[model samples]
Each structure stands twice: as structure tokens, then as C-alpha cells.
Target: MSKRLLARVAALTTGAALAAGAVVAVASPALAAPLGTVNLSQTSGLVTDSPMFASAVTSAPCPTGFGEESALRIGPAETGPFTNLTPSLGGGGYDKAPVTANPNRSFQLALGSAPANGRWWVVVECFSLLEGRHPDRFVTEIVVAGNQWRVPVVEATTTSLAVSPASPVEAGTPVTLTATVAPSGAAGTVEFLRGTNSLGTAAVSGGTATLTTSTIPAGSWSLTARFTPADPGSFGASTSAAASLVVNGPAGGVSKVETITADVDPGAFTLDVAQPPAVELLGGQVGGTATGALKQATITDLRGTNAGWDVTGQLTDFTGAGNIPAGNLTWTPSAAKASGSGAVSAGTPANLGDTRTLCSSAAGSSAGTFTCDAGLSLSIPDSVPPGAYTATLTLTLV
Candidate 1:
């Protein structure tokens, strides 16, 4: 070979050999990259200063084949004593001592009992004894605690009173009123009132109360009740609407005509005018009757457009549950007659009941609660008990 060619060849060979050596050195170190770090985390509801929790340590890694002298460094300062460190789960392989560090390795710590209130902390650390290695840093620290929860609730109730027929009459008609209180289980008392007068009172037993009144005049009246609280502030109070009473007049055509005296209190009125007695109905249901003298009675028609009169009534059973009603008896007198005279119209229902009274304002006016007077006969529904049943009619004039 020539000298020049031999020099070039030698240079080329040295350069290739150097490149190959450098490649091999880099590859060897890359194969075993040093671990970046070891991390630890924990969670629990248990209080501190107690035995460690078994399930508190969620993730922990321990180096494999660790020597007896090797130790783990956990926490910020790594100053806590490393005693009682163990796997708490029963029959767990990581329970006993001789714990070794392994990738994806975990240990269930045996936490002491929980404190009254607070939490527990568990930290996992790792140390290395490898030659020329730096001091072991914290691998990881896990914090865990228990959960606290509760359920909230709200309660409510209402009180109400249902009066039969709503409208009332006089002449001692029987009237029934019911008071209902809600919330199922509550203790309280209920009071009954007629206008501003106290009628009676009852104690609530199982959230219900009932009352009746008799001897109520033939004028409009109101019934009201209030419930007393059982626990002062524990529960709320309740009230019921007023029950109405109506008083009816004597039969028509027996003229001992009486005048509706003024002073009939002024709120509402419910009155019943008796059917004209001994009158004939030439071709109607009340035809064929005429043996007695025609009678006349005077009533203060407070409901008349003039002289300040507006009255209303309802035809219903004592229970107050039945078909809707439609009937009203009104009168308009010439001039401002305090007491007017009117002939009783015949054909009223035998068992007729009614009520009338004066009201201070138009809002309290009631009418249309009258029955057809056909005869002197009285009747009751077939469902009515065989025994004699009495009802109260009420009225309020103010």
C-alpha cells in the first residue's frame, strides 16, 4: 500500500472504533435508569392519638430484598419513631416484619383507635444503602380520615273547622262542627266561639275535636275555634272558621202576626218562615187544603235593598254533605219600613229550615237558604235513623 492510502485508512478505522465505543457506554447506563422518586399517600376518618387504621395506607412501595439495617424516611422532617409499623389486615402477607420495598407494593397500617374528634396521618418513606448513594428521602406520606354526615328534615301542619250547611238558623236547630288538625301526631286544645261569645272549649285528643250547639236564636251566628299549642314553641297554632245558626218562624196562615224586632244583632241572618197553613193549591203538589184562617207574620227583612238588608241561607243536612241548593226568599218594602208584613207563601217543604240576619257590610250577606212549603207534614231521608233526631238552627243579626 502507498503511504498516503495507509494514513487515510488508519484514520477511518480509529474514528469508527471511537464512535462504536461511545454508543455502547450510553446504552449500558440507559438500561437501568435511576428511580425518580417514591411517593406515599393516605386517607381516613379516624381521630389522631389512637391506634393506627388498617385501611388508611392506600399506596406504598418498598424496595425489594431490603436488608435489616435499611429504613424508610417519611414525613417532612423524618423525625417520628418508626415503631409498630405493620400490615393490619388479617392474613395479609405484608402483615409481619421484614418488610421489603417493591414496585406497586402496599401495606395496610394498623392505626391506633380513633380519637373523639380529629384525624390520623400515615407517611411512607424509603432509604437506600447502595454504595455512593445519597441519604434516602421521603418516599411518600398518605393522609386519611373518616366521614361525618347527617340527615335534615322539615315538618308542617294545618288546622281547620267544617260547619254543616255553612248557613245557620234559629229556634234551637242542631248544628255540628268538626275541627281537624294536621301532622298526624300532635297534642293541643281547641276552643269554640259564637260571634264574640265563648261557647265552649275542648281538649285535642289525637288531633280532632267536635262540638254542637242548641238553643241558638233564629238569627245569623258564627262559630270559631282555636287550637292551643302543646309544646309552646315545639309546634304551631291553628284556627277554624265560624259555624252558622238559623232560627225559623212559626207556620203561616195562623195570623198571630209577629214583627221581627229590631235589636237582632247585626252580622248575618239565617231564618226559616213557616209554610202557610191550611192553604189550598188548586192544581199543584200542595193543592186541596182550606180549613183554617189565613195567618200573617212580620219579619225584619234586613236583606231588602232598602233599609239595609241582605240575607242568604243554604239547604243541607246536618252533616253538610249533599246536593247543591237553590232557593231564596227576599222582600222589598215600600219606603223604609223597619218591620214589614208579608203573607207566607204556601208549598214550603215540610221539614223546612232557614236563617236570616242583618250584616254590617255586604260581604256578610247571605240568602237563598229556604225550602218550598207544601204542607204541614215533615219528612227525613230514608237513611235517617228511626229514632227522633234533632238539629239546631242559628242566626246572627250583627
Candidate 2:
């Protein structure tokens, strides 16, 4: 070591095992590491305020057989009346006033109790392998009143929240949220949330609270439940873990139906007819044939009787130079513009000799209107001389 480094100060060397079972230590060092602060977990089995934590680590060498012990003095300073916190060594080593080292050298210590009300000092002394105690090693002070910690705080009851009906609920479906308080019998209210929006609140009962809702819209939601105790001092407020909620929309292509109805009133069933063009008598001298069309006839059945109907036509002989028989006119009947559930058929070509069928509606079908038309072929017989002819055709519907 140089003289410049000599004026310096603290020197530390790593401890190494010596051949004689003893360990070599640093020459000297400045600065001491603090001991652990008072640590408190849940209430403990031991009745004292100690043993849970070790002092902040110290640089002092803790070789084999080295240990630390604690004691309390009744005064505001180091000179106060003292009491041994750890028992003394036994047998031939009884000559020592106080001992800290255990055979295993575990320096763990505890303050069993604050027996009296007064300012107290917690003194920890390190021990050498020779049963020697160094009181100057570690020291801390405390002011005790009634053997109780000053400004004591009470632990509050905790609560947990949960949701029901699982996730992936359909929109407009009911979802239930529940909150349960720990240790039971806690009085509080629970508020439900989806993201930052509030769903509603429910009053707590029997250590639990619930909320059910059915109006949530369709979407993904980060849902959670929160609890607020009615007596804040007795119960702690807590939020539940986020619950995943996926609300689905209505299924695709859904359809709704409505019924339609109509009423039918009793009405008259009637027929209508349009006049046909007159037939021109061509080749009058030889009594040639005349072509004409029968009038269009329509039948309307406003009465929903579902009964069928048909129309027939008959023609009288002409009373001109010589009368033509009704059989001279052959007709071809056709049904047109017919509307109904029933079927309509055209009558076959036949002479209007005696009320030949023109057209007919299917049986048990009708309830609508239909029109019947026909082409008339009047064949003038060669035996009859035709100067001028006139005839009457009668149509009847039944």
C-alpha cells in the first residue's frame, strides 16, 4: 500500500477460509448496513412484534459461531434500566454476562413483548466466537405506551366479484353479476360495469350482492363488477377480475310473418253480353254462306257460392225470302279472360240447333268472372234463296 492510499480510509477484503478452520476478514471498513424494518404480515401465531424480519444486511463478518441477540432498556436513551431479551449461556461459559452466539451461529432475534409503558431501546449486540458481546453493533429506539402499537390500524374485510351465465350471451339476454365479500356477513352494494359504463347497482345482502340485466347491446365487452361497503371502515372496496362477454346479434336472414284476410259479402250473380257484327249476305242468289261472330258474353258471380256455370246459345230460323234453319249456323266457342280457381272449357264446334253448350266453368269452382266468345259460320243452303235474313239468338247462363 502507498502513503497516498494510507491517509485514505476504509479497506475491505473478501473472507477466505484459513487452514486452521478460522476465516480471514478485511482489515477495517467504514459505514454499517441498516437492519430490516419492522415487518407485519397477517396476524401471527407468536404474541410479539419480532422474529419476522432480519436486520438490513450488515458488512460485519458472520463467520462460524457468530450471532446477534436483542434486549430492551426502559428509558429514552442508552443509559436506561435494562432487561435481557435472550437467556444467558450455561455451564462453564456462565461467566459471560450476556451471550448472542448459538452453536450454529444463526443471529436471528425477536422482541417478545413491550412489558411496560415507557420509551424503550431495542439493542442488538454481535457476539464473537469467544462468547463476547459487542453492544455497539446495532441499536434502535421506540416509545411504548400500553404495550400496544401507537396509531394502530385495523384490517378491512376484502371482497371478490363474479359474473354469471358465462360469456357469449345473445343480445337482449339476461346476465347476472355477483359480488361476494370475504369473511362473510359484510354489508355493501355492488356496481356492475362494461368498460367504463355502469350497468346498474344492487344492494348487498348476506355478504353478497347481485345484478341482472337483459338490455345489453351486441358487441365484445370487458365486463367487471365492483363492490362498495356500506361501512367503509369495516370492509374494503375491491374490483373483480375482468370477465369476457361477447354479445351476439340476431341470426342472419331471420324473417317474420303476418296473416292477411278478406271478407266476402253476398252479392248478385249476373251476366253481360256485347252485340256482334251483322252478317252480310254474299252470293244471295246462289244462297252462299255468311260468316259472323257471336257476341261476347260475360258472367260474374259476386256470391262466393263456388258453384259452376255454363252458357248456351240457340238461333231461330230467318223469316226472309226463305228461312234458314238454326242448324245452318255452326259455332266455335272459346273461353277467354277467365279468372278463378276453377277451370273453364270451350264448347266444341256445333250448330246452334237447340241450345248448344258454348262454354262451361269447372264444377265446384267459380267465384269470379269469365268471358265466352265464338265464331259463327252460317251456311246458306242451296235450296233456300236468300234475299235478306234476320234471326234472334238467345243466350242463357245457369
Cα distance off (Å), candidate 2, residue 348: 1.4
Best by TM-score: 2
| Candidate 1 least-lDDT 10 residues | 14-23
lDDT of 1 by residue, 250-310 (tens): 4462335467766644432333333332121111011111111111112344354323333
User: Would you give me the overall lDDT of model 1?
Assistant: 0.33
- Tens-digit per-residue lDDT, 151-211, candidate 2: 1232466556666688788888998878776657667788888899999998878878788
Query: Per-residue lDDT for 15 in model 1?
Result: 6
Report residue 275 deviation for candidate 1 (angstroms): 73
Q: Model 1 Cα displacement at 95 (Å)? A: 58
Reference-based TM-score of each model: 0.25, 0.34
Highest lDDT among the candidates is held by which one? 2
